[model samples]
Target chain A: MARRNQHSKEELRAMAIEALADLVEREGVDNFSVRQIAGKLGYTPGMLYHLFVNLDDLILHLNAQTLDALNARIDQAAGHGDPMAVLKAMAFEYLRLAREHTALWQLVFSHRMANQAPVPDWYVDRTRHMFEQVEVQLKDWVPAADQRQRQVMARTLWGSVHGICLLHVENKLNVAGDVAPEAMLESLLDHYLSSCAREGEK
Target chain B: MARRNQHSKEELRAMAIEALADLVEREGVDNFSVRQIAGKLGYTPGMLYHLFVNLDDLILHLNAQTLDALNARIDQAAGHGDPMAVLKAMAFEYLRLAREHTALWQLVFSHRMANQAPVPDWYVDRTRHMFEQVEVQLKDWVPAADQRQRQVMARTLWGSVHGICLLHVENKLNVAGDVAPEAMLESLLDHYLSSCAREGEK
Candidate 1:
C-alpha cells in the first residue's frame, strides 16, 4: 500500500502499460488477462483497474505505444534523399520492426475490441499518422497527384506492403513463391512508382 | 454408433468439415473445439478422431474446402475478355467473397497449425493454383515477362490486392479514406498494369 502511494496515478498507468507490453511480447495477445499484468506490477487486479477501465482499455494503451514506436522508427528512417528512396527505407524499416516485434505488431492490428467498439479518436489518429508518412513522400514523388489520388495511392501501396508483411509474419507467404518479402516489396514499389512517374509525365 | 457405421469414412469426413465450417461461421475460429463439431454431426469426439487426426487436421480440411470454393468463384468470374478486364473481374469477385464470407476467409488465413507443422503439399498446391489464375492473365497482359518475372509480378500484384482486402475486412482500412475496396482495387490494377505495359514497351 505504501509503495502504491509513492507513485502518482499517471506513473502507475505507465508502469502497467510497460508491464502489459512485456507480458504480451512474451505470451502473445491471445487470452491475455489483466490479472497477469497486475501480477507483474505487484498490484492487485482492483488496483490495476484504477488505471484502466478493463483489459480492452489496457490493450488499447499498449497498442498506442506500439504505434508510437512504429512512428519513431519511420521518422528515424526518413533521412534526406529522393522521395522514392526514403519511402523504401521507411517501408523496409517498418518490415524490420514488424519482424522483430511480431507480437506487438500483430496486437496493434489484430486486437479487436469487444463488440466492435469504435476505436478511440486518438488511436485512429495514430494509424492516420502512419499513412501520412507515406502521403508526405508521395507528395514529393508525384507532386501532381491531387489529395484524393495521393490518399488512395498511399493506402494502396502501403496496404500492399502490409499485406506482404502480414503474410510473411503469419508464415502464409509460402504461396507467393520462394521470393523474400523484401524482394516482393521492392518489386511492388518499383513497378507502382514507375507507373505513377509515367502517369505524371503523361 | 449405428449411424456412424452407415456412412463411409469419406462421407463422415466431409460431413465433419461441413459442420466445422458452419460452426466457425456462427461462432468464429477462436477457442473452437472438436467437441462442438462432433455434436453437430451427432458423433462423439472419439468418432471425430477416427475421421481426423485432431482439430488441426479438421480445420485444414475446412480451409481446403474454402480454397476450392474461392477457386471456383474465380473461375466463374474469369469470363473471356481482355486479360486486364479478366484480372479485374477476378479480383473483384475475390473481394466480394471475402466480404460476404468474412469468417471463412479469415479462418483460411488466420488458422495456424499446431507445432508449426508444414502445410501439406496438397494445400500448397491449392494456394499455387490461386496464384496461377493471376499468372494466366498476366501472360496475356505482359507477353514479354518470363516465368520468373511473371511469378514475381503475379505475387506482387495479388499480394497488394490481398493486403487491401484484408485491411478492409478487418475494418482497418478506415485510415486509408472512404474509397471502397472495389475502387481501390481498380486504381491499383490500373496503375500497376499500365506500368507493366510501359515497361514492356521499353
Candidate 2:
C-alpha cells in the first residue's frame, strides 16, 4: 500500500510489463491473470488498472515491446549484405527469437483482443514494419518489382517464414517428419529465392 | 437422468464428441470447459469423464475430426489431374476450409495439450497425412528427389502455405498490406514449384 506513492504511473506501468513478461515466459499466457502481475510487483490489480486500461491493454503493450525487440533483431541481421543473404539471415533470426523466447513470441500471435477491437495503429505499423524489412531487400534483389508487387512478395516470403516458426514452436512440424525447421527454411529459400532471382533476370 | 440408460457407452461417446465439435466450431477452444459439453448433451461432467480422459481428450477428438474433414476436402481436390493443378487446388481447398470453418480449423493448430504430453499417435498420423498429400504431388513434379528430399520439400512448401494462412486467419497478414492470401499462395507455388521443376530437369 505504501509502495503506491513510490513511483509515477509510467514507472509502475513499465515495472508491471517487465513482471508480466517474466511470468509469461515462465508459465505462458494461458490462464494468466492480472493479479499475478500485481502480486509479483507487490501492488494490487486496482493499481494496475490505473496504469493500463485492462489486462488486454497491458498485454498489447507487452506485445508491442516484443515487436520492437523482433524488429531490432531483424535490423541487426539485415546489415549490409547481398539482398538474398540478408533476407535469409533475417528469417533465421526471426526463427531463433521464436525458439528462444517461445512464450513471448507465441503471445504476440496468440493473444486476441478480448473485446475483438481492431489492433491499434502503432501496433499495426510495427507489424507492417517487419514486412518492410523484407521489402527493402526485395527492392534490391528484384528492382523491377513495383511497390504493390513487393508488398505481395514480402508477405508471401515472411508469411512462409512465420508459418514454419509457428508450426515449429507449436511442436507441429515434426508430425510431417523429423526434418529440422532450419532445413525446411533453407530449402524454401533455395527454391523460392532462386525462382525470384530468375524472375529478376527476365 | 432418464436418458442415462438410453445409449450404450460407445453411442454416448460418439454423441458427446459430435456435440463437442459443434461447440468448438461455435465458441472456439479457449476457456472451454467439459462441463459445457455435458450441459449441451444433457449429461454430467462425470459422464463426459467416462467418455474422455479429460477436456484435452475431448478437444483432441474434435481436432482429429477437423483433420479428417480437411483430409476429405483435399482428397476431393486431389482427384486425377495435373499434379501442379491438383496441388494448387488442394492448397486452395485448405484455405477455403480455414476461412469458412475458422474456429474449427484454428483449434487444430491452436489448442495445446494441458499436460504437455506428446500428441497421440493417431493425431500425428493425421497431421503427417496432410503433408503426404503434398508429397504425392511433389513426387510427380520432382521425380529425382529422394525420400528425404521430398519430405523436406513438403514441409518447406506447406509450412510456407501454413504461415500465410495463419497470418491471414489471425488478421496479421493484412498489416503487411492487403495482398490476397490466395495471390500470395499462388506466387509461392509458382516460384517454388517452378524451381523444383527445373531441379528435376537438371
Top candidate, metric TM-score: 2
Q: In model 1, how large is the Cα lDDT of residue B111?
A: 74
Q: For residues A99-121, write the lDDT of model 2, one tens digit per residue.
A: 99999999999888877777889
List, residue by residue over B46-97, the lDDT tens digit for candidate 2.
Answer: 8788788888888888889889999999989889898889888988998999
Q: Per-chain TM-score of chain B, candidate 1?
A: 0.94
Looking only at chain A, give the TM-score of model 1 against the true structure: 0.93
Docking quality tier of model 1:
medium
DockQ by candidate, in order? 0.59, 0.80
**Highest lDDT, which number?**
2
lDDT of 2 at B90: 87
Error of 1 at B49 (Å): 3.4
Query: What lDDT score belongs to each candidate, Candidate 1 first?
Result: 0.84, 0.87
> What are the runs in model 1 whose C-alpha is more than 4 Å off?
A1-9, A27-39, A42-50, B1-5, B28-35, B43-47
Q: Clashing pairs in model 1?
A: none
Tell me model 2's lDDT, rounded to 2 decimals.
0.87
Query: How close to the true structure is residue B162 of candidate 1, measured as C-alpha lDDT?
Result: 89
